[model samples]
Each structure stands twice: as C-alpha cells, then as structure tokens.
Target: MSPLGSRVLGRPDAVQVWRNLANARVNYSVDEVRRPSWNIDVHRTALPAERPGPPEPGGSWEQACRLVRDYEFSPPEIVRALYDPAAPLLGRDMLLEARFHGMHFYCGVRVTGVVDEVRDGTDRVWGWAYETLEGHLERGRATYEVVKRQETGEVLFVVSCHSQGAPTLDRITSLGWRLFGRRTQLRFYHRCAARLRLFVEAELRGREPLPGRSPAVGRLVWAPSDTRTHHRDALAIHRVAPG
Candidate 1:
C-alpha cells in the first residue's frame, strides 16, 4: 500500500485511486446511462442547430459528425470551460488540464471507448469516452456524441458524464469540491455544449469557428507517470448494441 493508502485504508494503489474518481456507472450501457438512478449527477443539453436545408448531399449531420470525431470540443477551453484543454493524444493515454473554483488540475485519462456508427434508429452517432488514469480530481467517464437523425435531417451534439469529487490530498481542493464542485461541473457542461454547437454551425455555414477564450486560474500538478504501458484495448471500439 502506498503512503496515501494508509490514510484512506485498503485503497493503496494510486492507479486505482485515480480510476475510482470517476463514477463506476460510466461503464454501464447507454440505456443504463439514461436511467434515473445514477449515483452521481447526470446532465444533458440539446445542442441547437439550424435545419440548413437538408444535409449536403452525403448527409445533413455529416458536418456535426466530423466535429465530434475530430474532438473539437476537447480543447483547452472546453475541459471545464473555465479550465484548460488536454495535453494531446499520445498512445491510448492523454494529459488533461482543468481549473475549478480557483484550483488548477493537470491529470491523465485513458481512452476507454470510441463509438463509431453507434446507430439509433436512422440516426448514426459516433463519439468517444475516456477514463481517468490518474491525477484527475474526479472519477468517471465523459462521453461526447454527434448524432444525425436521417428522418429529420437534424444533427445533434450530446455530452454526458457520471462523476463525483475524487479523494484529494489538497485541503483547498477537497473544500472546493464540497462547496461548489457539482454546480461548477454542470456549468462546464453547458458551456462546452454551447461551444460545440457553435463550432458545428460555423462549419456547416462554411465559416471558420472562433476559438473559445478562458483564462487559466488554479494550481498546477502533473500526473505521476509521464507515460503508461500502451494498451491494445484502446483501439478496440465498443459499439453500443442497437435497441
């Protein structure tokens, strides 16, 4: 057991500690995700879009689909909105940055799942979800999706996550989570969803989307490991079973 485990009891592994920061329910099915009994807070926001006269030959939702596929919303300004973006995708792992209630956090998450052509009716949805490797202030997976309804020719962006405050050694971080973490988290989701919609709309209109601007305000801490053992599991796409 690590020294940190002595304080928490039984949980001696830092890697396990990081993983536990996310809500365990994240690994459950999409239907389970929509269930009313999540252990942590659940959030959903419909991204607004103009019909724009059917999709552009190939598909109306193609533009939005590309945005989500390329991770337009995962940038520094979108992590928590008031925080920073990820370090970059290297192997199956990524370094994530964020600020909350005046504390800056530098963490890591492993790409756990990627959705490709996860079909819902005539709509095709694709996205990815990442789990905290270590250093994250919360534990849980956040999945981003771009869905196109073939019948309605509507493209929608959706973001969902199940998370709770992680056990932290920092006094301020712990206090901050206890006080305003949940509220701050919901705010991040709203802003990120809005930003994603703006980007998609800009692309659909043939206009370059402006980058979001948010000042970094908080502490800085890097993950304990510079790199993790590569995992083939990262490339394996976990497709949702059609209902």
Candidate 2:
C-alpha cells in the first residue's frame, strides 16, 4: 500500500480547487475532458528504444520510464519555460511552484497511478501519472508513458493531460492563463517528449546522458502575501492549500 493519504494538498480552496481536478474519476478519460468545463491537451512522439523487446521489467524501456517517473529530465527550468528555479522534484504529495509569461501559481499533487507492463497484446507500455491535489491550479492529471510497438519494433513517448483552469486570486494572471496557458503547456509537453527520447536513444547507443542545467535549489514551502517579505535566496516554496 502507498503511504500517501487522501488529503494531499495543504490548502484546498486556494483558488479553483474543486470544480475539475483529477479525483473526479478512477482513471483518466480523454473523452470526458470534452465537456465544456475542461480544456484538453496532448503531445505524442515516437521514441525508439533501439532494441527488440517484450520490454520486460528492468529493460531499457523500463529504465526510460523510471527516468520519467523520477523527473530526471524535468529540470525546474524546463518543466516550465519560465519558473522560479526552486521547484520541487515530482513526487507523490508534493507542492509545486510554477511561473510562465510573468504569471505565478502554486499547486499540489500526488503520484496516483503507475503503468508497468510487458507486451500487452500489441504494445509494451510503462510510466506513471500524478493526480491533482486540493490546491492545484488545474484540476486534472498528466500522464507520461514510454511505449514500444510489438510489430514494428518501434518505441514511442507519449504525454497526455486533461485539465481546466482553477480560479486564481489575481484576475490579470487568470486572464493571461486563460489566453496562453495551453500554448505554454503544449511547449512543455513537446520538450519533455524530445528529452525523454534523447535519453532512451543515448542509453541504446551506450553514450553518456546529457548534462543537466539550472538544478532546483531548495524545498517547497507555502508562501502567501504581499505585506510580508521573503529572502531572495530562500528555498523555493509554494503557497499551496492555505493554512
């Protein structure tokens, strides 16, 4: 059993916490996101594992999946085109601070689903997903998967997510979010797909992994307000569920 509990966020109603998060159903449904309230986005690319395989556990494909699950390529800077540079690593029950186009937001989520498999009928897939917690800006789930086609011997990387904007305290930020958030998010997805593919290919060729840049510096904390001041060098923090 997992150590995480039902309550994952520190603040449940920080903004749009309840209207449309990942907890609405058992598993993600691409079609359900078609509802008027939800905004959907998908990015997929082919990734060659470069080996013939049923993709057994501990194989290259699985290794790639582990990297994704562990957020090895999701450097704080790349996780979002523009970020605070101190965002926490992806994990179950973690709060995150994200910024883009001059807008900032705080949220939380927990690793809720995992995909591990061999050739199931025609494809071998492995990866995991994190479900939005109470204080999340968007109520939904994002899934990253590495798949290998059984017949063609091709491997692919897929990133899919279904979400809708939650209400935010700053209307200007919310407006900007409504207008350009999807585009920025799509960019993030594409970058992740490309990076993961590069890692898989490098492993296959016995080459060294690419060097990481601008690593995150500190733990996440809840920070809320304009009246109070915080140290510039403080560990990155998120004003998650309100205390």
| TM-score top scorer | 2
Q: Candidates' lDDT values, in order?
A: 0.49, 0.54
Tens-place lDDT digits, model 1, residues 1-243: 112222222212333334333432222233443333333444454554435444454333566665554455543432422112343332244445454433334455566777777475466677777765434566667777776665665667777677655554356456766687677677777766776667766765678674333222232122211212124423322111000
The alpha-carbon lDDT assigned to residue 107 of candidate 1 equals 51
| TM-score between model 1 and native | 0.60
Q: What does candidate 2's lDDT look like per residue over 1-243, in tens digits? A: 011212322323322332223343323334556767886666778766445647655556766876675565453442321122243333444444455553334455666777777655878887777765554556678787888876766777777788876553246445666787777777677667766777777867777565433233233222211112235313333333311
Model 1 stretches astray by more than 4 angstroms: 1-60, 74-91, 211-243
Q: What is the number of residue pairs that collide in model 1?
A: 10
lDDT (C-alpha) at residue 130 in model 2? 75
